[model samples]
Target: MPPRPRTSRRTRRSARAYAILLPAVAATVALAGCASTVSLEHAEDAAAVECADVVVRLPDVVAEQAERQTDAQGTGAWGDPAAVLLRCGVPTPGPTEDRCVTVDGVDWVIDESDAPRYRFTTYGRTPAVEVVVDNEIVSGTTAITDLANAVSVIPADGACTTVTDPADVTP
Candidate 1:
């Protein structure tokens, strides 16, 4: 009798399982690729109630940061956090800058990028707010990471969530 080839039961079982699952894995990947959501071309047709469109009231962090900035700049009074966030910082690249305001008790991040993901912490409430600048801010952002730790100016009330968009928007 000819010698039989050596084979393991576990190996046969593994091969059978892989053959059965290969098609399923491939189909799942293909479906995921096709299920992506695309943004609308015209801004007018888009939803008017975007996070950027609405500038909710800034909490303690943003308020205090604004006050500190005002005081640092030798200004008498600190204006509104939203306005100050948009107009306060010196003009720079990316146009997707960040504006934070802290009024001693409360503070919130004011990312000028897409969704404007900001965070606030106060005695009564501690919630995060992502403030996007309607059409101005695209789907991405333009700010450096670790801004809170990198820049001492960021108050303790605030914390960095995500990295800022690159300085340049590449095609």
Candidate 2:
């Protein structure tokens, strides 16, 4: 019988390394395909450490929608189509004519200019948190309520209030 050539140690090691790595790479790619990342723009103060605190505390599931991975810092998205999107470290909202509601001790200024999709921002918290919810997909109330605890990580410096004008009163 003819003698066969022996495989070199380096070639055998390379084959072994590939054999071990191929499956891992395939599995990782498969898993990555399963979970789609939601692209989002970072807030102005997204780099702030306080934003990290809020992001870490975000709920896994919000308004019956599961949380998805976001590309930006201090941002969170829930729902496959992303019915709810949250951005922390946004500019603090100034007093406006917009309606404000307090949920779970957190005051949120509601902007209804865009119907079916409302923008709710923390009323008094500096580096305010902004939550945009699509009413058709999920309840804005539920989304805001679910996010209250996490958003409350930033202490409230002020609160939503109604200014009474004396001129409106009839003598």
Best by lDDT: 2
Clash number by candidate, in order? 27, 0
Question: What TM-score does each of the candidates earn?
Answer: 0.25, 0.81
- Best-matching candidate per TM-score: 2
TM-score for candidate 1? 0.25
Range of the 10 consecutive residues with the lowest summed lDDT in candidate 2: 162-171
| Model 2 lDDT per residue over 64-151, tens place | 9999999999999999899999999899999888898899999999998898999999999988999999999999999999999999
Instruction: Please write out the lDDT profile of model 1 over residues 66-159, one tens digit for every residue.
Output: 3212212111112232222222122112222345444333333444333343321111122222222232222212211211221223223433
Error of 1 at 157 (Å): 14
In model 2, the clashing pairs are: none
